[model samples]
Target: MGIPVDVISLYRKACEHDTALSGYYNRNVRVESDDGPVMVRVPSAGAETMDLAIWPEAALLDAIGPHVPSAPRLMHANIDPPFQIQEFVEGALLDDAHPAGAALPDAVLDDIAAFFSQLLAVPVGELPAAPSDWPKDGDTASFAELLLRLVRSIRDRGDQSTARLYRDLGVPEDPCGLLARRVTGLSTRPFRLLHADIHRKNVILGADRTVFLDWELALCGDPVYDLADHLHKMSYLPAEDERITAAWAQVAPPECRAGWEEDLRFYRAYERMKSAVVDTVRWARLIALAAEPQERRAYAVELADKLDAARPCWIPASDTVLTPDDIERAVDRWSATGGTG
Candidate 1:
């Protein structure tokens, strides 16, 4: 959590090895460098192409470069380790400056829509098909299964608090059952390019520019899924949502747009339910640290706050504080005591 400043300076000096080198994750000192900042990308190895590829954060800017001149350009890249040298456009983190949860001004939201407009316009045919490992279960029918698999992955890891969170929340089971039982006849749209993880952290704000970063999860399927991701994570007001909704509508056929909105709502819920596994794991990991008891307890409370924020939209579980006893219950449910990751 703490960064060492001297080490940072030394890393900056790494530019010397390959003058073009901006920097790299974990100094291997093997790859040649370049003059300016560079980006490193690592597509998930041994996986199918449809699975999320670890594109450099800089590429997000590159995606918008034709439309926005001030946006960062990705100069170079290394896919093995997966990092990039981006322009590092200076500005406040979007969440800090636009604290209404990325409730940006009209100009800012327009810029975001413009970026997506460009992205959706490009012919996805040019993009390669996902590798063999890309999850075959990516369609609407597979949604519940995918959520279960991810949850099962988490449960298999055996972190008590996380496991407890699922048992307490009833997870994809509860939500998926509701969808199948209530949200009638949901249709599946084949995959399209998606910025599947479009949270505020991935959007960088500048004085005159707002750049989206982190496109590792982009895949050529289910564009609606991406829209839902952005809306769910950022929670922009109806206006922001409407604008983005309209932008995508421009590229989609009228019929596609009509069905898309309804489907997006479902996927949005699916994403939140699935993301809870990750969030609970995050909290459990922090609580397990050897840090002070106060730190652990503090994180436990913070976990509650995160769940609370996630609840009004998704996360139907009670707002109970996560306690060791809760985890023990999950551990019993999982029939394991460790690594329910």
Candidate 2:
């Protein structure tokens, strides 16, 4: 299907103000309205179908608006195509404010903890139910099962390169089983709504406050999983990781922190496994768009770098690691197979 006429009209009007800021999954344009500036998000076709959530970000924002103050307020949304208009949050992205791979400032850490604490306070019973396939609330086994299902779905969808990579890295075919075996003596905690993806790029640092963006990957799961996802995605330095972890512990409810230190390792591993599969699919899509050899090489390098960093987290003792050349070969094979398994 072609772009909707209404969407085109909206884009044309938005373009009058300035150029649209392009992101990997969404195109954002700032438009001035009678009220003020509004951010219009046009999600990529791929992104709209990536998750099975009942409501998109806009709807989620509306449901949680009464409780969460650190997120953008939704003004409008179209459910069919997944387009949204929200209050334009004025601030620098955390990525722009801090250097890459640097530790976040103490003030920023405090802001994050505060936001998360407030978010956790919102009663889960008030929110919409997640799709049946999603992990069940407070069920660590279900969380592990969900991760395995995602991996299996990717492999079954003909992404053999990702499957082989997982195999070579010694990631067990049965992720749920592996998780169960590893956590035989571990305890479970209460689950809550989580902003499953909270990398630096998703955080906006305003003069006096911090705002979080991109709620597309939100989930209802163990709260520690949210912290683990954030820490891994931020790639913070060791000392900074410790400091941030300590800061979160200070503000988080006692139940949220119960056995967190012990459970964090498994969560991090799950995150790494999930990220690897997601990135493989993303890189394949990117490679298909690269018309030049240099562009393809650059994409391969990026994929290799990501895989290398995540290797230890997912499979710490594995002897197999993909070099850039190995990644290039894999990409070539994927491309040869027409990006299928």
Candidate 3:
């Protein structure tokens, strides 16, 4: 797709110097400007519209500037057009270096642990308010409540294809209450800033240090949640996963380590359910709107694979794990419903 005219105009006005479009996705663009490379992120064109909060990454980068040497710096932003210009940090994505399902090197693991330790130290008072849907600081009930809200929202907004997937999977009617029960009796840890999404793709391995990217999902929550997120998303080997957990326990604050083993299980299950919902919704959209039959089929298969991977994490074993054939049938049914159901 062509880059938006307003983004092109912003690049010209900001640098006046020659600019090269380095990357483009949806409406967000990365341009190499005279000053330096910058990322122009457009909020309206993305899929996360349900989130009502203004992008908090720039404000967060400002607050933690002194402490986090590797975080990208915010250069400028405009709310009128909903564009953010941020310094583009240069480094290989951790996934690019260590592919998914591979063991991460010890050095990388240590750097990641240290990164979380420092992030938790940033005073929440200096940061902007988190997204309204996010749980308030240390409010364990809010954690489960937020997940339940999201599940309900997805069901309400999703079409028949998504509903069918949910039914086939036997997703609980009251996931929030279920999650709340699972997490009850856990010792409450002091809340701190958490990069709620810390997979390999968001970790940039720099020459001297590791820089975290895409703070858009950042929030204030239990620090252990961050560790659980990283462990689940990184696809670490079983042995490596255990070692990394041990390393994090050694470095994480004492309060953060309380009920670490049990809490990780709860967090992992939550993450899996959350991922399943998101993927199912995306697949439904693709089935309805994607013009290419090949593309729709590809995404359906991918989503099915993701659902399968998350099967083990479901609180109660799901009734049915979706297969590629089942997804294709759902897509056909969606088409038959004229994309309305």
**Index of the highest-lDDT prediction:** 2
Model 2 residue 214 CA deviation in Å:
1.1
lDDT of 1 by residue, 224-336 (tens): 76777787778778788788777777766443454776787776765665555456655655666526867766766655555444454433444455454454344344434
> Which stretch of 10 consecutive residues in model 3 shows the poorest summed lDDT?
17-26
Model 2 spans with C-alpha error above 4 angstroms = 1-19, 22-25, 48-54, 80-82, 132-136, 159-177, 183-186, 284-302, 308-318
Candidate 3 lDDT tens digits, 1-341: 55556556765564443443322122345666667667765543435533212345667777878877757777775555455787676678788889987778889888877887788778877777766666666775566455557665765565565566566544544434456566556667777877767777777787777888777767677777788778878888898888778878887778777777887888777677667766665576676676888887788788787777666655565657777778767766666766534
RMSD to the hidden true structure, all candidates:
7.9, 4.5, 5.2
Shift of residue 254 alpha carbon in model 2, Å = 1.8
User: Candidate 1, which segments miss by more than 4 Å at Cα?
Assistant: 1-72, 79-83, 100-103, 133-148, 159-184, 188-190, 237-255, 288-302, 305-341
Question: How many steric clashes between backbone atoms does each model show?
Answer: 39, 1, 1
Off by over 4 Å in 3: 1-28, 44-46, 49-55, 129-136, 175-177, 284-302, 308-319
Clashing pairs in 3: 160-341
Best by TM-score: 2
lDDT of each: 0.53, 0.71, 0.67
TM-score of each: 0.64, 0.81, 0.80
